[model samples]
Target: MRIFALETDINKIKQKFCHSGESILLSTPYHTFSFFFSSIRELFITIALFVVGIIAFIYDLPMGWTLGVLLFIWVVFVFFNLLKAYVDWLYDFIIVTDHQVILVDQTSIYKHEIRPIHVDNIGAITTSTQFWNIFPFGILKIHLKEGLGGDTVMLKYVPHAEEVAATITRAVSSHQSRSQTSAQRRELSGIDDSE
Candidate 1:
């Protein structure tokens, strides 16, 4: 039963985004560390509010009930903020296909941006690490041609960034080879037509 549901979901995704002869080569969300980093501010705020609520309750302050109400609201706000952060982290993914690379940036439940770059437009791919490689996460940067969705697309906190970059590089080269073969065929056909 579970496998059936998973298959259905996969089919739905393929139908929605994939074209004929196009297959997904790689699809990965940002590393787990990114989720904590993205929601760090909210976590700190929640901790501070919780401490204040505890102190107010312990002192039996005159306005303790009001403070409790305010803290309750603050808790809700923090919960939603963390939810948004998780949603952003989980949904924002980099997908490499045979024909193109797709970046899905989901900032919130209601907002997302999809950037698709054809493999031919990708000029260069590089990876960078933070804090002298202390962390396992790294960044993947793809340099694109002019007028192709700005200059570069950077994916932060990517686990195994080097592997992902290599996969994209391979995809780009594969696309170039296929394009050359097709162009040669077209040129040969043109000669035959002229003859």
Candidate 2:
């Protein structure tokens, strides 16, 4: 069920962002551990509230009914919070196409930021994992060429970060080589643009 939903989302994004002849090389979300850590606070609070509510009811404490109602409302709020976190995680993804790399940072239902970096503008790709490689998670950073923002785009908690970085590096290399070949052909054909 979730896989279907994810496919649907990816399809929508491709339709909206991808250009003609652009093919997706890779699409992935942050690691599962990141999602768990992001929502840990809410999970703990929900559990604590449930336990307290149960204890109140069992002890026949004063205002027990009111306490139950309040706890129920709180639980509903927490549930919605968790749901929002899940939605954010589900919608956020990194997509690498033959032409560019797209990062969809979905913060809420109404807000999302899409950053697209052209393959030709990619200067470097790097990945770093935690000490001792405790988990199958790491960060991937793509350093853009100067003047095109001149900043690094970082993706955190990426699963199999090394593989992802390598894929992007290959795409960048291929694009650059193709561009150079076209330029050389133009030069050999005596194509003059300085008119």
Candidate 3:
């Protein structure tokens, strides 16, 4: 999506919002912070069942009881999917802006928050993953300077993470250069007033 304009002093930004180019990108770190457990929920359940199954086998439970345990596990798997969906809907974030990066987040249906990441303060764009995620669904982490305060907003599970990171990196660099030049000009003019 193309950046159209950004007004940092007013805390406003605008970006292209065509459905085709629109993307929901979350910081891998943020995504993992919120729903990282969802990825391993099934694994933990499976392991617990394996341990229980071994104990049940030792006790020689009736075939009916064994079937019941297996059914319970199946139900748990279905419930896990529901939980994952809810997490996805709850904390999803989209970075939308034509000139600067604005983090648009929905904390809840009734509450929403948007934070702008100064393009100049965006330090680096990168991605990282945990040991387990590498094999199946790899995670992407974008690192940035804490200019506007707080941690970097990660883009998690992004399919084309490298490409997105590159775009952000370039944009941030350009923003910084422009900011440096502006600062120099303002200092030379000795104008500290904001209007």
Candidate 4:
């Protein structure tokens, strides 16, 4: 899939480091119900319009006029969808290097908020899949650490959220393990110096 936008600092940091010794993985593109449902609805609308155009031609209505109307509607639909896709793509809740979680939310070109949470500091991870959001599909509400402003991140509508949660948990645990090992190494080095 095409990457529309990546965190600038994240990119810069990765380039500066020669090697992390472990691969940094990011999650797949996720969208809200509104996005997926609208796209699906547009497909149906396009099909219905095609059928109507054929019917108009058969009934001796001006074929050119019918086609023009359909074209106009399609163009409008596409324009709106393009905007929606861009916004949805920008609004991502991301985990980076298993050390940080960043939520990039864009309200407009000039208005936005970027929240960063340290994975080591995270207190808890909670997930909720609501029935209404399932609509034609379900979404996972991933809440991380209470009391931290905007600590919760939604994966929006996705398939197999349990598997995704498992993946995230593993990443977080791995980071935790590395941190612990580093602390222990530091302590051992200090003891050797004391001797």
**lDDT of the candidates, in the order given:** 0.79, 0.80, 0.53, 0.59
Residues 64-132 of candidate 2 have per-residue lDDT tens digits of 575867677776877677866886677788888988998887766656677888898899999999545
lDDT of 1 by residue, 57-106 (tens): 77887565758686787768787888878877876677889888887776
Model 1 / residue 11 / CA error / Å? 5.7
Highest lDDT, which number? 2
TM-score against truth, every candidate: 0.85, 0.83, 0.44, 0.57
**Model 3 over residues 21-134: C-alpha lDDT tens digits?**
434333321334345455466657767777777778889988578868776875678455645544454455445332355555543334445666655566666665545555
Instruction: State the RMSD for candidate 3.
Output: 9.7
Select the stronger candidate by TM-score from 1 and 3: 1
- List CA RMSD, all candidates: 4.2, 4.0, 9.7, 6.0
lDDT (Cα, tens digit) per residue for candidate 4, span 1-195:
223343424344344332466455554344465455546767777788889988998899998888999889877876466565556554543444466555555433444555655666565555556575444334555565656664556555554555556666776898889889999999999999999
**By TM-score, how accurate is candidate 3?**
0.44
Error of 3 at 92 (Å): 2.5
Which candidate order results from sorting by lDDT in descending order?
Answer: 2, 1, 4, 3
Stronger candidate by lDDT (3 vs 4): 4
